[model samples]
Target chain A: MDVTLLSTGIANVASVSAALARLGVRAAPSVDPETCRTADAVVLPGVGSFAAGMAALNRHGLGTALKARIEEGRPTLAICLGLQLLSESSDESAGTPGLGVLPVQTVRLDGAPRLPHFGWNRIESAATEGLVQGGSAYFAHTYCLRPSGRLEEAGWRVATSVEGAPFVAAVERGAVVAAQFHPELSSTYGRDLITRWLERARAQSAVDTTQGATPCR
Target chain B: MSMTRIIPCLDVRDGRVVKGIKFQGLRDAGDPVERAAAYESQGADELCLLDVSATPEGRGSALETVAKVRAVLGIPLTVGGGVRTLQDAERLLCAGADKVAVNTAALARPGLLTEIRDQLGAQCTIVAIDAARTAADPSRFEVVVRGGRDRTGKDAIEWAKEAVEAGAGEILATSWDRDGTGEGYDLALLEALSQAAPVPIIASGGAKTPEHMAAALRAGASAVLAASIFHDAETTVAAVKSDLVRLGFDMRLVSAPMLPSVSENSPLPS
Candidate 1:
């Protein structure tokens, strides 16, 4: 499957691309809105501040195109800062607006032993289908998304946690899914997660083709 | 809880892996790609490639080696030595390095740390401090540069604190006196730096056994880095990890299937 990886200009795109290639999926790094809109799947991989990331997306004119794809129920995966960028705003860069795809806010992980929650931590998955529940993934960030609100009516659910403080580890609302961990650097479990996402993209493409929709470019 | 990382440092000069006794008497270890792949298969948590030459002519070859090693390895790769400017760090990152370690240049111009951090994020910026115990004052350690050939009078602990405040996310503290001696890590130095630096401290130099690693971790190091042990094949990454686990240190274990080999059922795409 061909996937368009949105480059926020601060992430390690090479590593993300290599991870996807290992899962048998072709990944092309692009900030072009048209390319992102035409792919079988779109991955928003990032590793920088919310302000810098959002500025890059706006500079490339990809802000609206990305939101439209997710709103249309297209397969999209946001990792780390990419996940934080989906929120309404973040404490990391005060007053900076996020993509606002998910109704959430990102804040510094207070009361933790350190600032950047660096290293591997076990993720207790809330759902079974979208991500591998009960597995550890590598994390390296100081801020995390506050837990989803009101379980029943909330559009998203908590996919994982580190410590008792629950954050949006993986969120699934329609075709929009995201993880607060670096799957590209999470070793075996990371590879498995990418494989699962690619399989879903392939399955979705098959369905679209059967319904006479244009295939992803 | 954060897992303790085991990093194998490959000192590369002229594009070849080299090991020396206290930064002298350099000898070839092996090809960078081959040794890096071998260590990865052995379950090394991370790999550090330090260009010993750190010269204009050698910088090109070091980046080429980094790209080649990155192509075959899946773990995080940190390239150090000769990273003086933001452009140098950018070039290494573009070549597939997850992080870049800066030492001499950062010390010369402290602002370089902040500059690199602003451009690349603190997570990608690591300050490598080479330190030696002061003869007059055994309690305090002095910073050394030029591969431990010169001493700068600045206290090691003070320098670490300054580097962290300057936006360095981690400190690679190498004990120059204990380096390559196989006498084990300088626990007193690790303890002082760990207490002084807010960011994670990677205890480097003079690691001989798993017990030594344990001692460093107990003394408050976030990770343990060694060169001679892994390069000389006196021990394996898996063996050291298992030993650490037995001693109750949190370590990431590589499952049997993850062991190095070309399998017919490999999950990698064709």
Candidate 2:
């Protein structure tokens, strides 16, 4: 499978690229909006401030390209800061607008004993069909989106996890998957999840090719 | 609650894992890459690669070691040992490290933490505070730096809070009084710092048994770091995690059936 490691100019793409390589699928790193849009699968990975992440993406015009790609139901996987960047705004970067592909906003992880919510945490998925499953994944973030029913009502499958309070861990609709955790650092569960996602991304891309239909209307 | 982390620390000198007593008498354990793979198979939540090399030339190979380990391991990798400037931390992060632990450098100039945080993010910056109990005041802890050779005269607990405010996301607090003692972690130190520090506290030094780890966690450490026990193969990360689970602590558990075999370089199990 052709995978594009969407470079946010901050995250360690080597980890995700290495994870894919372990799965015997080589990933090409790209900051180009065109490659990010047309790749068979694109993994948007970041590990930093929401404002900085959005600024970098917008600088390269990949933010608009990603919204277009996800709107077209093209295979996309966003991780950590990448997931937060899909929201409308964030407490981490107040007044800084995100891509707004999803109707959500990121807020600081309150009520938790710690701030960053670092380390491996368990993800509990209610949707049986979604790529997110009940497994542990690596997380390093200060801000997160609480489980908002509005996201689910917006036609997205949201998985919740508890760090301080229940927060959205993973979200998916069609071939687009977003997680507030780093699957690449999740070991076996992550490898399995990536492999499964790759399989689905391949199939969905194939079906979309034949259907000649746009996604997300 | 955030998951309890079992971190296996590698003190690498000249690209090889080394065993030492209180950071002295270094002896080779194995290749950093090989040791990382073993730790991964043992379910280590994260791997800490510390460059214990004293010479400038020796530090060069430490980055090479991190790159080699990153080639095989999928867990979170935190690299440290002699991060003197923001450039040092940046070099390590650019060399495939997920997190950079700074100690002496952060002490010398607290702004270094802010610089790393601003450029690389707070999650990437960790302050590894080596604290030795002050002899004059038994209740007070003094910060030690330059690989525990110099006394900073700064309060460890206060520094932890300041470091966090300065942009350190985590504190890897080690007790000089208990380092390499194997008597168990310094509970008082752990409790004081855990309560004082706003960020996650990684308890280090003097952990000998699985219960020692549990005791540290109970004392308030979000994660536990050990080198001698895991490096000497006295116990595996899996064993410690199993013990944590048996002690009524929830664990991620020994991974699924597909974790790559440590015996050889293998592709992801499909």
Q: Each prediction's TM-score against the native? A: 0.93, 0.94
Candidate 2 chain B: worst 10 consecutive residues by lDDT?
A: B261-270
lDDT string for model 1 (B11-69, tens) is 99888888888788888877788777777777777789999985698999999988887
Error of 2 at B194 (Å): 1.0
Model 2 residue B177 CA deviation in Å: 2.0
The lDDT leader among the candidates is 2
TM-score of chain B of each: 0.95, 0.93
DockQ leader:
2
Candidate 1 lDDT tens digits, A47-94? 777898888889998888888787777888888888888888999899
Measured with DockQ on alpha carbons, how good is candidate 1? 0.47
| Alpha-carbon deviation at B152 in model 1, angstroms | 1.0
| Runs of candidate 1 exceeding 4 Å displacement | A150-152, A163-166, A173-175, A214-217, B257-270
Candidates' lDDT values, in order? 0.81, 0.85
Please provide, for model 2 over A54-80, each residue's C-alpha lDDT reduced to its tens digit, 9 standing for 90 to 100: 888988989888999988878888988
